[model samples]
Target: MVQHVWSVNELGEWLAAVRIDPAIFDLRPDYCAGLMVVAGISSGPSDTDSDQWLQAADSCDIDLDDVHLEHWRDAYRSFGAKPNRTRPSADALSRRAEKNGLPRINKITDTYNAISVLQRIPIGVENLDAFVGPARLVRADGTEQFDTTNDGLGVAEHPEPGEPVWRDDTGVTCRRWNWRQTPRTAITDTTANALFIVDALGPDAHQRAAVAIDTLRTALATGTPSATRYIDTAD
Candidate 1:
């Protein structure tokens, strides 16, 4: 896999350093487990994998009213943002898959989505070829351009000031701490190099994020040569 420079910026450093709501361990710090891999996309999920996806969706039934999830949601709220407005992608996908069937995107995207639902962690994947790194996690200055779609028409927007986002030299790669990804780095069937970011909360974040990353890495390795690297401020 290709090696890309990744880092947390000054704001990210501050967020990682501060302690918030001592009663809630998830609010203590920001820890992310990131993996960069080079792989070919599969046409689609197999019948067996589709069945596993459904099983994973069923397993998350309890999350519909899970207090732990509420606490996790609250942790994000402490950052001065609304959870519903900036809900982690994993939380949204899990809820949607639990209600409707998971949308089949592609092998790489679907694989990470399945793992996200099963592990209950936010996983963000981006096409490395579309980026001009070094990749960084920082608070947005409200000037970074975000290319997205609205009502099937293309739209370009800017991130809110102080919003947590991942960016490259060009513009915002991901906004709202994984709520939305820009089209510039969206993974498609032709994407050959990609980056997977697993974000976790709570006291067991390190262990949980590690497991999620390893699971995805192992899954991808079965089809192609894959490599992984970890990023954790707590360490």
Candidate 2:
């Protein structure tokens, strides 16, 4: 078993170090991020996990017009990105779940995706082993490196200036806030330590995010889960 070495203090310190640009809150005062850091995850996809994903997909009823989704669209527009051209992560997942159900990526990925669809929130998972440093949410300046894939080939890209992104010391890990994730820190079957981010908006964003995080913790209980701590940027 590949046990993670993140002690309680280290985990809390790492999550505590996650910074969000004050400008982001200025753009959308309702914006809130619910971050959960978990280690000691030791399970692969199973029949139960598949059932949970399927249930969430089957129950998904979100559309672009959803109030929560509209908040994300407005945030994207505030950052000079077209939401229709690049939908929010939750919007894309909801569409997929409605059309053909969500894809089974892996146990960890499936767990977070299920919660995202079921809760109508955007969730991102990161493989901590690939992490370069503490995560930070910032408005990009167009010079950071983002490792992604195009036409099945690995390539590098950069975020547009002033675009919202999640990054570390290396570069951008997720571009446009929650639109796309770089392959550099994407969760895989071998992932044991993971960071789960649940994004919400509107006046009740913090409450909604807390609910989503609770749901995530319950679902992850099927696996050998050990959560380090939970942080809500709204605090």
The clash count of every prediction, one per candidate, is: 0, 0
RMSD of each: 6.5, 2.4
Itemize residue pairs with steric clashes in candidate 2: none
Clashes in predicted model 1: 0
Q: What tens-digit string does per-residue lDDT give for candidate 2 at 1-235?
A: 3445876667777888888888677777778888888776654664576577667666766565788888888889998999889999988888888888887777777777777877779999888767887888888899999999999999999999999899999999999989999988887777778888888898898889889878877777624334433333433
Q: Which ten residues in a row are the worst by lDDT in model 2? A: 222-231
Q: What is the TM-score of each candidate against the true structure?
A: 0.77, 0.91
TM-score of 2: 0.91
Candidate 2: where are CA atoms >4 Å away? Answer: 1-4, 222-235
Q: Among these predicted structures, which one has the highest lDDT? A: 2
